[model samples]
Target chain A: MRAKTSAALNRSELEEELRAIGRRRYHDRHPFHELLHNGQLGRGQVQAWALNRFYYQRSIPKKDAALISRADSAELRRVWRQRLADHDGDEPGHGGIARWLNLCAAVGLERRKVESLDGLLPATRFAVDAYVHFVREKSLLEAVASSLTELFAPDIIADRMRGMLAHYDFVSNEAMAYFDRRLTEAPRDVDFALEWVLERAETVEQQESVLDALRFKCDVLWAQLDALYHAYVDPGHIPPGAFAPQDESTDRPRRYR
Target chain B: MRAKTSAALNRSELEEELRAIGRRRYHDRHPFHELLHNGQLGRGQVQAWALNRFYYQRSIPKKDAALISRADSAELRRVWRQRLADHDGDEPGHGGIARWLNLCAAVGLERRKVESLDGLLPATRFAVDAYVHFVREKSLLEAVASSLTELFAPDIIADRMRGMLAHYDFVSNEAMAYFDRRLTEAPRDVDFALEWVLERAETVEQQESVLDALRFKCDVLWAQLDALYHAYVDPGHIPPGAFAPQDESTDRPRRYR
Candidate 1:
């Protein structure tokens, strides 16, 4: 863990460690996900997940901008800068954020309130802010390492797209534009990060750190699900000042948004 | 989330946001944590946690050294340099890492194997490296901001100490010395980081970034717990190539080292 006591691991070994971490710990394996994809959650639970997740969606542009600000080279900045455009776009009502907002609207959350983050869970804020901070405050290698969680995102999004669209009437192919774009965009971003981590993390300590960075990023994603599960699933323990479920009177789970 | 549309918030508001993030998103809220603190985890689960956490304890010196390497001023370096000493001491078996190894030994893991990090989870590796890289790559302000997670650590450590000592047969007063030292050491570090962050982050963007940095750090800690919980607690889904339990054939769990 420290002192660089051993010889450097080859890139393949480091990659294997990272892939193993993802396979074992990705949120796709989380029980909340099992509940989600299997169509076991109610509408209100689904609504709560979407509302809280909006905080994450809204944060991507800030994270991308921070990465751009930190990169020293023009080429690096130029290649990476596309992320900001991909999330924010040239005009209002376009791109990923807009699509996320459309999803929120489809689920019955008001855009202004969502923008204000008035009902956003503290867990959502913490998780999203962590990501933006991870991009801004880690080394370029580490920052890219953190983004490696994207390697697994396409599968999760596809699961989500298939599950939500099929199970929830509120979900539509149009509302899933955010995920559709991500299916394309995340792969490109991940390819860059994977190559960057492989090439730059040359020493044993550096390679271990890079592998760990991806795991840390996975935790970031997984923790969000834990929060959602705690707040909206079986336990339903909502924290103070988080978004409240609209229907709380019944012993049985209510229909979710 | 982008463009910094509003003027800077008052410092109190910024502080509130930071505190709120911690209150809501810190690992103290994770259920696996609740289980650990309540002494509900089996010995094997506890062993797995201690073994993996050794990786975190081992990385502190490297993170401190990285912070020292990135700072510009003698004053900043002088203040931060104590961290390396606190963790490394004058020789082998002298400092925080040594104390942590002692704790590992007390908990029944071999000090040598723990140091080897041969059985560490990929998640554990990822979270620890993120902290080290955060120190090495981020702006001085953001680096300090990331360390502010220490501000919340004392309470959690105190809880763990009380719970583990009271509940677990193998844990003892000597084993808790690492956390005891942290109870003192963390305060000094947190004071510097909190004061530095409050004083230096002048713009709204800077302050928000600082706040987000702390939140990012909380996620890092929380993510580690998520990994621990998934591997050892309720789902008990250990990742491939991670440390395995000593006994798996019976319905009942067994004592582990």
Candidate 2:
């Protein structure tokens, strides 16, 4: 367990503590990610993942906007403005959410169904919404700290893109554009967020809150997978009204059928 | 799927729609509940349920208070005030939360661990926080409608009480005082809430929102059970830091041991 002590630490020590949290609790360590990164998950299981994960993708811009709204100065908000544009784009039919939709479509989920969020797991909605609310309600330092999950995201995105390309015959390099985009975008965002959090969290209490925020954010990402693993993976009992892929019983990709 | 139509119906039709939502979507129909109410769960599994559920039990008054804070009238606030008293009591250590802690204690969990929320599943925290946020942020009618899950609560509580007492020697009637109190309290609370919803949801949009609110509330309850079932039941992969039972490998009651 991470110590809950109130004793203050040096800047480098605090940064190490934050990095340690990502090492231990990031969603990349989750079993679902393990299966997802490798070829272990079936085609329908992959579709289930894409379908539910669209909720998180869709919420990113909204959360970024909330964080921008809470930012203290034009400098912070100006730095954060790239995230909104990065996810939302300069015009319609663009950006991260749309790219995610493309990935969902590539996986054989209907475009309309994915856009409508017709069969999202309730747990996904709750977790994503909680993250947005955390940014909106918590201190600005904590809000920036929460985005520190991005510190770990680029590595996972690389692993995911590499694994999916190699393992899934149906998945093409073009279809993995979202991860490719995030690979660059995430590092840029995290660098600013990490520096801001480290510079601003000067006191023991603020530092602990920063650590807790990242831990909370990690929990948010981790819980999303736990829901997926539970509902669509082992002993799979899809909750009433969640997406239930038709080809779950088969190992083959039945996208066209 | 529940229809999202805007065509207004008569009061009875609206009431029927709301009741139908409960019939189809309430957590009672969740498989985890089926296992628990049928006396199929092991003692450690039961402890997992109680430990995670303590979060939900602990949040009721906070949600109720949020609802009360939003009430437009003394009359409405006055009616909702009983929920606060019922869950929190006239004095410390006297009401529903206290009774739930008693139930947790009787289930062989240490009091400090449960109170500290040491091993809470992130999904549980997310789902419960979503419910509370719904009450705090949504329309008053929708908030009250969310509580309409109470319309179906009595039966489940009775089933839970009987099943736990019959199947688990570690459980006793006193351990279930929480449910017994809720049995009477829920009906009275729901009567007012149901009537308020029926009387106030005068427009088609309002009625539809009310129905959606109940559906949202059911999703909250069902998602909590999904987390429990995922973590403590079949192919269980307890999330890192979540409560893990020591005797999960055995079916025998090992509370004393």
Q: What is the lDDT of residue B134 in candidate 1?
A: 70
A1-257: candidate 1 lDDT, tens digit per residue? 33468877678877777888788877788788888877887667877888888888788778878888888878778878888888888899988888889998887778888788775665556556667777877787888788788888899989989998888887789988889999999999888878878888998778877876776677677767766775676345555456776664674544322
Local accuracy of candidate 2 as per-residue lDDT tens digits, A35-114:
98898987788988998889998998888899888877999999899999988988987999888889988888899989
Return the lDDT, model 1, position B180: 90
For residues B1-257, what per-residue lDDT tens digits would candidate 2 score against the true structure? 44557468899998888888888999989889889988888778898999999999899999999999999899899999999999999998899999999999998999999999998999999999999999999999999999998988988989888888888888999999999999999999999999999999998789888988999999999999988887888667777778877674674433321
Q: Which 10 consecutive positions of candidate 2 chain B have the poorest summed lDDT? A: B248-257
C-alpha RMSD over true interface residues, each candidate: 6.2, 0.9
Mark the 10 consecutive residues where model 2 chain A has the least summed lDDT: A248-257
DockQ of 2: 0.81
Winning model by lDDT: 2
Local distance difference test, per candidate?
Answer: 0.77, 0.88
